[model samples]
Target: YLVGGGQNHSNISGGGGQNHSNISGGGGSEPHVQGYKSQNKFLNKEILELTILLRNAESRERSLEVKYVALEAKLCQVESKYLVLLQDLKSPVCSSSEQSPAREVISRLLEDALDNTDPAEHAVFKPHPVSEYDVFGFRTVPEEDDEEEKLVAKVRALDLRSLSLTDPEVSVGVKWENYLSSTMNRDMVHCPELKALMRSGVPHVHRSKVWRWCISYHTRMFRDNLAPNYYETLLGVARDKPNPASKQIELDLLRTLPNNKHYSSPGADGIQKLRNVLLAFSWRNPDIGYCQGLNRLAAIALLYLDQEDAFWCLITIVEVFMPQDYYTKTLLGSQVDQRVFKDLLSEKLPRLHAHFDLYKVDSSLITFNWFLVLFVDSVNSDLLFKIWDAFLYEGPKIIFRFALALFKYKEEEFLKLQDSMAIFKYLRYFTITILDWRKLMSIAFVDMNPFPLRQIQNRRTFHLEKVRLELTELEAIRQTFLRERDTHTDAGPLCSDDEEDN
Candidate 1:
């Protein structure tokens, strides 16, 4: 009817009829209204199409970033192999004793070359030529903090020779490099010397290779049992599927290492690589999904590993090295470790532990992240890497040693601070400002000697059961409260039935 009326009004408007001019004017505007609606629909369609295009472009860009990172890692591996060959050629053929120093000098030169090259030169994650970030790709503290500055300067000025526990006569370093280079690698049990060498520290040039070898040595069973291209397959599955952890992973990508130059910007390649590593792991282990501390593990791994290698390194750490539920929602494993840590603290550092207990200080508050992230942000990068060198080679027991060492190293200073808050605040920055890595490591290994791995395992088992029982009791209490609340709701108000009847 409206269409018919409009047609009649249109005829009247064209006939110049003054009596129906208002109707004629309304009809005359009808086409303009229709045109505007059509235009709006077209624009909406265009917007929808463009939005999809933009999303597709972003997906492609991420894919390219992952590909680029993988390729870069392969290139680095090739370069490393080539450099090893070159160094082998340069070394003099002589008696083992005479060749030792030559091999050391050659390896040192190779390390310098590898360190000097800017792998991320064309990449977005290149570190700036400034003091904002340390050589380890961690951000430096503000200059206003004189104490932090002084400590950082001390660490920077530390002679490299002082860092090594082994002397020239000790053949640990030489034997370690040889074992790492050999095809038929022996287990840590067979090569006990590697432990002493690792405790001293893996050489900077061979650190990455050493980590790969150590992780592979430990996780060989897990890695070998996997199908070919398992990591890549995980990545493909993650890319195609919408994971429950993807959103949380996205939120944490930039937050993972924002201070580091590699992850400074949102669009940095490190961010993408981190995202892929986490996302792939989430897909690989849906039960664990993505957890808070995994990012730190993966980020640090990335500094010395490529994207795929980093992903597998994470798997090795989370699934193989750590106990079950360490990164679960409850973090029950972490809590259990903390409980065990407190127990060890009391036994090892009795005075400090007694002091903490007297002050009502919960030691776990200061040390939980240390356990969760393996002291990533708690300590300076250089020392942290040294700790990791031992950690990957020695297993989680290294964490307990280091944790005890930190408190032991600062026991005197800690005893002076009577206030709990002051102690907590001080402990936070003290590890980062450690003047000497060697002293800290010594305190961990030598000072905390006879630190039995078996004891840690036994304690962990005891705490795991205790934590489970506590959680069960808490759940039962919650259920009882919920049941009572439901009963009360079902019974209604005391006066409600009578009032309704009335």
Candidate 2:
């Protein structure tokens, strides 16, 4: 300290010593004049350094943006020229008018220009962009929160269904059918033989028996693991004491794959089956009640198994396989999957993720419904059913495999897209185009070492721990609210709607 004229001066620094500053008593917080000047000098130096750094960053960003545009433009030009040249060589005369193939060229550009995107994303899509989805019909964008993602406003699958496969895929499917028919009657649920067969593909003829065998005999036989009386008891509750969830379940049921013959009418067996399953589940897990997406799960499960088995399949899907909060009242679980998926995308497809971020397009906006319905209307009927078979045997992580594949395959188109709606529309249009399940799954699961069971479980464990902590906090808050509520004279019934805020 230095004695002054009616003032004192001392030195103070954040660490060991002080500079020309005073930090003594009431006005000690104020820096000395000299200290202030020194700080300003230091700050000016830092500002200049930071400004230079920022300028460098901005310059680099602009340079990269230019490079990206040039790459895309060159890709598009080369891609268009190649398509035109091929068409001309194939045709008797070379002319652009006879062969108006810009769309095809664009599709080729996206797929063939492998150098334009990371190989991981590049590998997922096919060389062709043409899908039956492009030719078939209209698509209405679903509302943001609409769980019944019946986005394919119209689908004409019957005409295509009548067409013979006329390929080796049919024979392979047949081979699996004959093999399952011969050996699946055995008492044991799981075997190396069974797993190998499923990995190939379960035949439609043998699906019912195969699914039942897998669930009943193959899955764990613990009572707590089973939803034995849950279905029956819940159905009884739904029958006797009607609840609020029942109405929503009915509305969702009406919209659930409305075009599918089995579900078109309210009086149909499929609709009734869906209603019973949803209602029973609502009663079974009152906390979640009947979430919108569960209807699709039950509907598909019902298609493959009996009602009881179907209920159990959904139970396994929602409770055991999936991150639990997925279908909760608040949908807290699906959000976690988004976070995990975002990390995976960043690692697996950094370029695509950066493009999305640069355009301010959130991954969740494009991915939520995909996870919710397991690619219900996102892909064609054939793909959806096949994914379900793998999804069940493998676990919920298969959806991630499918999702990563969706982005990877469509990276070029995704990159070309500038706005959120364009990206979503592109996804809706292109994802369903690839009717070949074999090729799609090959890129997703086999081509690269996709996420393994352990990785998924680790992330899920972290999410569950987070949820547990949140619940503990929520419980404490609830207790505090109760105490606070009691202190008020006009504290109504403790079960007020406001309590949900906790």
Output the number of the lDDT-best candidate: 1
Model 2 agreement with the true structure over 250-277: per-residue lDDT tens digits: 7898788765656767886788888888
Off by over 4 Å in 1: 1-130, 141-190, 493-502
Alpha carbon lDDT of each predicted model:
0.75, 0.66
Q: Report how far off residue 128 is in candidate 1 (Å).
A: 18
Worst 10 residues of 1 by lDDT: 121-130
> Where does candidate 2 stray beyond 4 Å?
1-167, 181-185, 188-192, 217-230, 418-421, 463-502
TM-score per model over all chains: 0.67, 0.60
Give the best candidate by TM-score.
1
Q: Any idea what lDDT model 1 has? A: 0.75
The TM-score, computed over Cα atoms with residue i paired to residue i, of candidate 1 is: 0.67
